[model samples]
Target: MPSLFSWLRRLYSLDTLDTRFTSSASASAQTAADTRPPAAKDARANSIAQGARAPLWRTPEFFVYYLFFITMVPLMFKTVVDASNENNPVYAKYSHLLSPGWVPGRLMDNSDAQYASFHDNIPYLVALLVAHPLLRRVYNLFSNRSAQSSTSSAAAAFDAQLEQRMQFDFGFGLVFLTAIHGLSALKILFIFNINYRIAKNLPRSYVPIATWVFNICTLFANELCHGYPLEPIAMALSPGSGTPGDQGTLLVQWARTLDGFGGLMPRWEVLFKVTLLRLISFNMDYYWSLDYPSASPIKKKQLDPAALSERDRVKIPAEPAAFNMRNYVAYLLYSPLYLAGPIVTFNDYVSQQRYTPLSITRTRTILYGIRFFLTLLCMELILHYIYAVAISKSSPDWSIFTPGQLSMLAFFNLHIIWLKLLIPWRFFRLWALVDGIDPPENMVRCMSNNYSAFAFWRGWHRSFNRWIVRYIYVPLGGGGGGHRPANGKPTGSPPPSSGLGAKLQKICNFLLVFTFVALWHDIDLRLLMWGWLVTLFVLPEVLATMAFPAKRWSSRPTAYRVLCGVGSVGNILMMMVANLVGFALGLDGLNDLLASLTGSYLGLAYLISCCVVLFVGVQVMFEIREGELRAGINLKC
Candidate 1:
């Protein structure tokens, strides 16, 4: 109907609309195509990350081994129980009459009481076992969620962060395994009197030889689960062969050649020997396995060039990677302090490639020497006295003392031992607090804090505590940098950096730290009760700290000086009471006495005495505080 020019214009407008639609659709399609590669690549990276993070035993091998061991545990327990019963005819004859209705004869008499104890402890064991797998799944889910919400860089950073934790977890697994094994053995020896000599002469000829072979095989299977070699040669060449004196030494050296190599040959050989030596040393020293090295997921990796320019870059020193065998040997031989120690980090140890005195000074070398002498003196004199007067005397049917007297003595002895230990700790703290020490900065900071007054308490006893923290806390989701709301606050409570937040944070920190402090002593009902009571008493001081921050007081001369003195006295009393309570609970007779004493007028008197002591404690704190204040004022004037 239109002229030719108008027709051409109409055609152009329609074409423009069509072109716009086509271009928009093409753009959308192209965007989707471009995004697909990253999504796929991200997924691939995640899979790789997960693969790297996965525990060593992914297949059913660990399960199969666990089941096999579980079955054998019962059998081994039975053997020991029977053996114990046979040895103790007195118990064997009368135990039936004394048996409570709840305990079956088989359950009471079973050689595998320790192993079966785990069976009875099914709830706890199951909880621990299930917790790890469940936590892993939960972690994975959270990781995925975080990745989805975050940029690729953030996601990558998270993965790397998790990787460091994984390394700690892996290392701690070795410690945990060692603890379980050592503790089990110790329990058997202490409770059932299972003689180690029995193992040495376990077989009585051909049949015994077969039994030994079977036991050896079982041991091999157990070691295999832990990624250790079960080769007989490895055992023979291990340091401090269970045999006594020079005969054992010669045998160890001779067995070294069985590997058809020298003592320091094959890397696996060294690892195996070291593992053996560590185990042997743990047994010899009656110390826990806090130093064992295990396979780690956080292998050394090249840093990305892009991340180098970041402001928060942690510049770790460039140190040699080789182990200082000389220092390692020295640490083993002379330093009983490391029997429970600084829990030397691999990084710290490797940094000192030479035996230089400066390196030693940096490592608080002077303190090490002081600790050695002090520890030896305490072990010889103080511990010996406690052992003779308390532990030995407190045993059943003591000729020199009544059970009550012995119990009281035992309680006081524990206090003495704690005091003795404190002396060395004070020295260690002084060394740590002094400037320019090469010890970890965190260790120094922890030493400086008044709350951590107990030497064997968490940060101060770095070796054992670090092992426990790594093995237990991190895996349990408590230790990692994952934010825990400030103390006394609810789990999901808003952080307390704001005005209201500070109070909540303080409360949470107090409760959490105290609870941890209590649990760290041991896993027993008595320990828990003791911990709870101590926390109640200690909470006020912690709250005070929160309410009046140390820094704030430091600025106010009069207040600061007074607070310092009070703090010192308060901390000492709190520690002493905590130690005494812990000691009383540990004593078999003392626990009974306390339980019996709880319902009388005398009990009321005892309670009053405790309260009065606590009051005097306050006075002591005031005096100390006032003294510090006077000193500060004089200095200022």
Candidate 2:
């Protein structure tokens, strides 16, 4: 059987070669250095090339993803609209399910409940799963094809090489991760018996079952659900009744409690402080700390006073820049305007600060502000409508809903939360475009004059992405080092300065970028998990960058490359675990479980420990940034 298979394979290879050889030999060959060309053939070739390079919107993947998302989004929207309707059985069932925990006269009135129903939309979850793969593939193909067409007739010699090199572990790993998520989704639907398309009559005992189903479903919903577990669960756990009557009673009791305690402000203030602390902690851990520089070069004893005085410091140093914590923080907080940054770097920030006048850029800034405001307005309108519809219906008996109907209702609520969460991305982009301006040098270097234009599509709503690139990528020797180019030359010249041992430097970059990203988003175990998971790409890139400072890692053995690829797959799994944990934590039931476990441990010791870790992280970041700035200043002099 093996011999027969080999013979067939050989025959297939011969046939392929014959076809290719005949086609090429019969085709008209042009002179190697022709001054003139055949117009008709040249036009045809140009047409073919242009077709291949067409915008992503024209690609099959893009269209498929778009169509799928569009369909799903509307379907989910309809589900929410139906559930919020006063006459809907689902609304009545929801009210009944919540009445047991409700204080009469405190819940939303039927009219308000009607508005809230608009929140139910499972389509967003569907869209996330279906759209991501298509978009990623399209982007990968577009990048590869563009690279191939840019080279000379020697393109064939390097085409295979470029293709192989461009095969990033990140993209392939994500696909597998997505597949697992898809399977999880199917499991959710089957186990929960969620009829996501319908708003239906259901009984009260079904509430718990529904809540469980929704929570499970939400876990797999992706960014669309904004990490909310499920609606039924939320309603069951809500502070007030499902109807206005319950809400009024709850409010009165709350007022009485406040009167007994002197006022609500004291407790409210505590809540506010906790929220602020959490936000700071979350951002620090996920966004800033992971990439916090190792230490100041002056502290590390790596900086040389003699080298600082050299005139031709531009002669790329042998060592890459060392990780400095101060540089990271400075990059993070340099521009007060970008404090809520679309994350930028010390170098990019400096360039923009020096070149773009605040007064001159006011018009562009105003427009961006307007855009952001509009997006906020739209989100508010949607949320308001949803709240009004879903929270005001007449209460139903616990006996009214089946387990299946209850589950569907819970899933419906999860959809509402997701829609609410996504509102931030739109406004964030607007804010970045308005507030973040690129310098003139950046315009020339980035191939665009409009700072907002560059940021509009890239970092405007993606401050964390910018943060990763600047604080993590640049320091580990990714971004064009801290200096501007001379006479508009390409920045890809051989390195002249190296500070961190090449291997260590790369690893530092990966760890910092992924770690910071994980911890910056939330101060939870899930974010920590995510940080570790994302480190997959960071670790390899760091090693690869160090191994071949001049991009020579491509020549490394295939076995080594395969190992890196496998490691990346493991990273993706870790990320998925992190994301799942995040979703679980967002659920009230999960929070209750955790609180039960840790509430007793919220002692002075725990508080002190947290403070100490925070202090060390911040101190490290500041020291690194200060060292970098000093080094930069000296170099400039």
Number of colliding residue pairs in each model: 16, 76
Model 2 whole-model lDDT (C-alpha atoms): 0.34
- Name the weakest run of 10 consecutive residues (lDDT summed) in model 2: 441-450
Where in model 2 is the C-alpha error above 4 Å? 1-71, 83-339, 344-354, 357-367, 385-461, 474-512, 533-580, 583-637
| Whole-model Cα lDDT of every candidate shown, in order | 0.35, 0.34
Over 205-242, each residue of candidate 2 has an lDDT whose tens digit, in order, gives 34324433443243334333332233334455555645
**CA lDDT of 620 in candidate 2?**
30
TM-score of 1: 0.35
Supply the TM-score for candidate 2.
0.32
Model 1 stretches with alpha carbons more than 4 Å out: 1-338, 354-375, 383-411, 416-495, 498-538, 544-637
TM-score of each: 0.35, 0.32
